[model samples]
Target: MAQKSEIEWTDATWNPVTGCTKIGPGCDHCYAERFAERWRGIPGHPYEQGFDLRVWPERLDQPKRWKKPRMIFVNSMSDLFHKEIPRKFIDQVFETMESAHWHVFQVLTKRSSLMRNYIRKRYSDRSVPSNIWLGVSVEDKPHASRIEHLKQINSPARFISFEPLLGPVGEIDLKDIAWAIVGGESGPQARPMAEEWVVEIRNLCERDEVEFFFKQWGGPRPKSGGRLLDGVEWNGFPWQMVPEPILERLAS
Candidate 1:
């Protein structure tokens, strides 16, 4: 089942898979890990493994149960491309997405190389399902290159999530990219995010005409800072797959 998210970027969150390992600086003060540990003693809890990177095959069919159309954030508590998740399981996840055409699945991952390899080998012939939107997480300059890696895939819709914004990622090339989501880190021990950092990327998205969504002004307590930037909220979506023939119709 998906939770009604307070996250401004997306509507709901679905974790077909739960638990993930820290792979980067952004992983520090992980909300997922904290949530898992908090429920460690609870019986039948999905995050029993803490943050050790586990997959729940039983939860894979959750989306199909939802009859209404929705914008779903896939694996919010874990990474679908984690090394521990088997290739066959990845296929099963995709199988669910393929069957649930009414729901739009948004998948963001930190493992780009493995994603590229898996799609190229096992899932090559199959087109990235129209209802599925693929995205990569790039919290700093080093991970910025993952954007290029995402570009190589023939996904119907592609985007980037720059949340837990650790450092400035200046001037990203939004060539084939459809959307850009930016936000700062938030928690008790949250790191500081410079205003200039947010503005720079926002400006870049404007210049490129890419739909930019500003998530929050994260600080020691995100609730205190709130998500407002200059007295406004950015809630844009890059609908890249809507055929050119229908684009004009949508514009009117």
Candidate 2:
């Protein structure tokens, strides 16, 4: 069975691979790393080794077993495109998503270039399945380059996550991008996210005709400040992008 997730955008979490190292500022207060390290040194725990990059080949086919149609956040516990993960293992993960057309798979990675290259190599002869949505983590303006890498991908199901929005993402080109999720950092020592920054990205999405979702106003907790952005909730999602068969089943 798939582990249900509290994440607002997606319905469930699937981690065929676990653990990762921080690569940038957005990872400073990583929730996944925090959760995993708590169980470190525990005997027989899933994250017994803490957040040190581990591959679980046995869990590769778990998604194929879920009968109900639902949104699956691929590798919520780690980045699938992390350099250490074997290419063969990555291939297995993709194959499972490809085979399980009944479910929508959301694959987000901070390793933007690696993801772009891998996707190109894997789907060289065929187009990526519509059920699979590829995206990159854009935490601030400097990392906006990742969006370019994401755009270079051949698939049309592209999205961006600006969670932990640390600074203004100056200006971005959201063309061809179907959805955007923006939220502030939530945890101890969490950096503050200004309302102007949220409005800036929201305005950009509006200009690009993209679905914009304001996840929350970060504080000690995810809901500390409330999800209201300028007095209204933005729950925009790319509903039209969902494949017809699965969309029909989910709607029923």
Most lDDT-accurate candidate = 2
Maximum-TM-score candidate: 2
The reply for model 1, stretches above 4 Å from the true place, is 240-252
User: What's the residue-level lDDT of 57 in candidate 1?
Assistant: 79
lDDT tens digits, residues 89-185, model 1?
A: 9899888988877677888999988887777676578767767788999898878988888988887588899988889997678867788898888
What TM value does model 1 have?
0.91
TM-score of each: 0.91, 0.98
- In the range 90-134, model 2's lDDT, one tens digit per residue, is 999989999999999999999999999999998899878999999
Candidate 1 lDDT (Cα, whole model)? 0.80
